[model samples]
Target: MGLIFLGIGIAGTILPVLPGGPFYLVAAFCFTKSSERLDNWFKGTKVYDKYVEGFRQKRGMTRKEKIRINLIADFFIVLSLFIVDILFVQIIMVVLGLYKHYYFIKKIKTIKPGEIE
Candidate 1:
């Protein structure tokens, strides 16, 4: 999964249509959970430093990043809600979606690119 996300992230960096940041973040997370060596290697890369370092440090994301990540997540959640007719699952999805927005809005401090270095 980490390698898959890393591949997508690399491709996203070259492709105009795909956004790289979210995939980089997922790759970093997967690498961290899977192996210490992989996590260290990934964290040493420019991609991880550029995309995930600030978020890891609790410095938050740019407004564009927050919106893009939220929209991508919301799309999948809504798709699942439509596919699964279970009321409980749908309710959970709604709550989770709300919480995601709230967390990003309140917990993450939006900062300027200049603030990063």
Candidate 2:
């Protein structure tokens, strides 16, 4: 299940409709809960290695990067909601999407690429 979320997250990178970072975070959390080995592997992954390092090092994301990522994510989410037109569900998704953005920002603010544990 964690791996599935990770895969979806990766796919989400290309597809504007999917949520990437949240999925990755979910995968990381699930891996930690499910298997130590998998958790280790996830931390070792090249793509996520920086995140793990940053998290351990307590380094923050560059302001520019944060703004760029937030803009892109917000744009996609709004576009998705507009196209989907799910009304109440879309509203909930908007909140969740904003929450995910906040979570990413908070994580990036605290973690630096060089700080992997």
Report residue 18 deviation for candidate 1 (angstroms): 21
TM-scores for all predictions: 0.60, 0.54
- The Cα local distance difference test for each model comes to 0.79, 0.70
Residue by residue across 1-117, what tens digits does model 1's lDDT show? 999999998885654335566788899889999999999999999878777896777557778888877787777778878888999978887887787788778877887766744
How close is each model in CA RMSD to the real structure?
A: 7.0, 4.6
Top candidate by TM-score: 1
Give lDDT: candidate 1, residue 9. Answer: 86
Candidate 1 collision pairs: none
User: lDDT of candidate 2 vs native?
Assistant: 0.70
Model 2: per-residue Cα lDDT at residue 108 = 54
Q: Deviation in angstroms for 99 in model 2?
A: 1.1
- lDDT by residue for model 2 (1-117), tens: 889988887887656545566677778888999999999999889757644344344445656556766778778778888788779868876887777677766655643445453
